[model samples]
Target: MFIKNKRVTLLSYWTSRYLLTLMIGLLIISFISALWIRHTTLENRLEMIEFMAEEMVNRITDVSIPGIPPDERVPNFAEDRFRIRDMNPSMYIINTDGEVISSNLPLEQREQSTFSELINEKEEIRKFTSAKNNKDYYAVKKKIEIDDELVGWVLMVESKDKLTMVKQEYGQLAILIVGLALLGWWAIYFLSRRLAHPIKQVAEAAKQVQSGNYEINLSDHIKEKEVYELVSSFKQMAGRLEQLEKTRTELLAGVTHELKTPVTSISGLLQAVNDGIVTGQEAEEFIRMALVETSKMKTMVGDLLAFNSFAVDAVPVKISQLDIDNFMKDFLAQWYAIQEQTDIVIKIHLLHKEVMISVDLIRLQQIMTNLLTNAEQAISGTGEITISLSEKEQYVSVIVKDSGSGIPPEEQELIFERFFRGENKKYGIRGLGLGLPLSKMMAQSIKGNLHLVESTEKGTSFEVLLRKEG
Candidate 1:
């Protein structure tokens, strides 16, 4: 009944080490208990016999007369004159010559050798089994004396049937102990199987997963809540793996399509030049167009390489502390000079003019450059790009906000994923979509995070959080 699923054999469960050890321990305890009971029973019976024997000696001496032979001096015990207390033993009187003078034994047993052997015996107590009746007995002897003269002996003989009855009762108790032990063994066997079955199910599920089969259904196997949670986690992991495989397939297709465009264009241009389709100024213009396409392809290839390197930590970070206000002022000046843009209004806001924080200067600059590039592309005409810096308790924040066409709500989260392109590609000749993802990776390597803080139809703001120096 314990093996409800019938996954393992009952014999094997019972033969497990846990149940075997418990049964053996119980058996040993029962045996020790039986031995102790037998010992205590014998001690109590002997003590009772010793105390009864001592009392009989005192009674006999008080009844006897002085200066007379033990035979005639003592009145016949069978008569009412001299009496001894009878406490379930056969009491007897014997003279100095080993002949019975008086006895409580049956008349036919008076002349028996079993009775004759006990007369005038100096021993305190002896055990004997009678030859005629074939029954066990305890015999105790006390001397009968008058005024310090030894007259005769008084003997007390008791049957051992009571002791035998005590042993039989103990035997019943041993049987009960054994019965209870067997019951306990069964209970343990079932309990152990209950505990082991859940673990076995988990092991089987793991084997399936190792073989690339993640469709494990543990609904039928109910166990503890924790085990259920483990099964649930495995299911979730399998689903994620499936999604990743789909994404990988899509990435391969996209790469093939993107690479083919520039290569096809290059092949067409060279073939046109060889055919002499045009001459003079037209030829020069075609050569310049081809160079532009080649440059675009080169930039895409470079982005791919950078993304791959950042993914595996192949690029190194050089950490340094810099003044927040001064560092951003210099960075913005260099960026604006490089762009040579006169229409964009670049504003700067600083919570602290001189907040020093630790960062990889090169990596942080690259990340901010990527964000600014994305913002400039989003703007169609004259717009404001605001760079705000603030210090928090544990981190320093750098937010870049642009007054341009914002990202769509649905595409905000996926924009940071590798090779993910948003809906707004209006700037012409879109990038390979690795810039934001690679920037995010670089941020994470420095124990920081880069995220789109907010985006709406009005504008979008991106924030970079860096750990503040303690």
Candidate 2:
């Protein structure tokens, strides 16, 4: 059974999560704010009703005659005079017997006994639900006193629904909160897409590379530093891989042709001798030629194996402290003795003082021999090969320069790439192009480095850097 995994895109994932969180957070805040506003609005409405009730009490008390009986004392005043500020609560003057004496209530409502039933003598203010109208109302009461004697009470009643007008405002607040949340989500949507765009391009480019297509294009106008770096690095890597792939294809064909040549030569020479086509001395010469071919083949194979082992970190080095001046003298002498071309002149310039450095002799010899051999090969017949040593800071530099036609300007940068042979050497050279790369690897294994300082038409110079003894 095959099961496919679910995947979420960056755009959808980020936007959806942000929207959900924003909506939930805004809803919570709006709910709490709405409740607070509703409570405050109701409290403020009650305070207004209480103030209006007190004012009405004063008006009723001022109009009362001193000797008049409470039932007969109908304080005469204009109905508009009792209205205070914006509050127009229903005002009533009732006796201690709970009978409605004077009121601003509608005639139809006063005909009903609901007002007397809603009054609470023990409380200054009270809330009641009217059975007749099926609505909530608030009744605020204040005592009317004539000469400090409580004669009757003044009541101010207002509908609870009227005081709760914040419901409409709550709707507006909810819309505002949602609008801000949507605006924030819009901003986040673009931001997430902007961030994910470059990364998405890189991912698609990677897929193309995986399919063996190195040619890819990505936007270069990115303003963000880190994203720009990612795109730039990937483009450079793809170009390098393309170059490496081409080199690898060329190397494969070259290796096959090179190995086949020596094998064919050895087979032909041995077959000629074995067929009795040449006798004694001539046959011996044929065998010698075969041995030479075999030796060349053996050397090529050894170099290949050595390079592979070093690449995998299997080759080990033996480090020892050696005097640089003496080591170079012995090394050049032995190299000179093996040269077939006597016209190639060798010169050495050593520092005045002896410099002791820690190095692996065998590895160092391999690096120098490769450089010297390359320099010797570069010179046609007569040319100078200068081996000079210098000390700077805590490092020693060995510079090997040759008076031969230098490496072509175009091929200089790729000298140390594996299997990358220069244009001239690709045709003239007979072995695998691992000399410079292997030499560099060996130099690094011994805690040193080999690099081409400069390679011009005049001459080419290579430098080897080694750490000096403490």
lDDT of 2 by residue, 238-258 (tens): 998888888889888888888
Indicate the worst ten consecutive residues by lDDT in candidate 2: 67-76
Model 1 agreement with the true structure over 1-470: per-residue lDDT tens digits:
47676665543666466566866887787778766776676556656656655565676666635432343443333563323233355666766766677676666765446655765355678888977678888787777677778776767677776543465656787788778777876777776666557666667877887786767766546566776777677667666665555555665666666777887887787667768986678777777778887988898899899889988899888888877777788888799779864577889897655678788988888898999998888787899899988876788999999999899886675688777666566226357778899999999988889998999988999999988766
Q: What is the model-wide C-alpha lDDT for candidate 1?
A: 0.73
In candidate 1, which residue pairs clash? none
- Report clashes for each candidate as comma-separated counts: 0, 0
Candidate 2 colliding pairs: none
How many backbone clashes can be found in candidate 2? 0
The CA root-mean-square deviation of candidate 2, after full C-alpha superposition on the true structure, stands at 6.3
Error of model 2, residue 387, in angstroms? 3.3
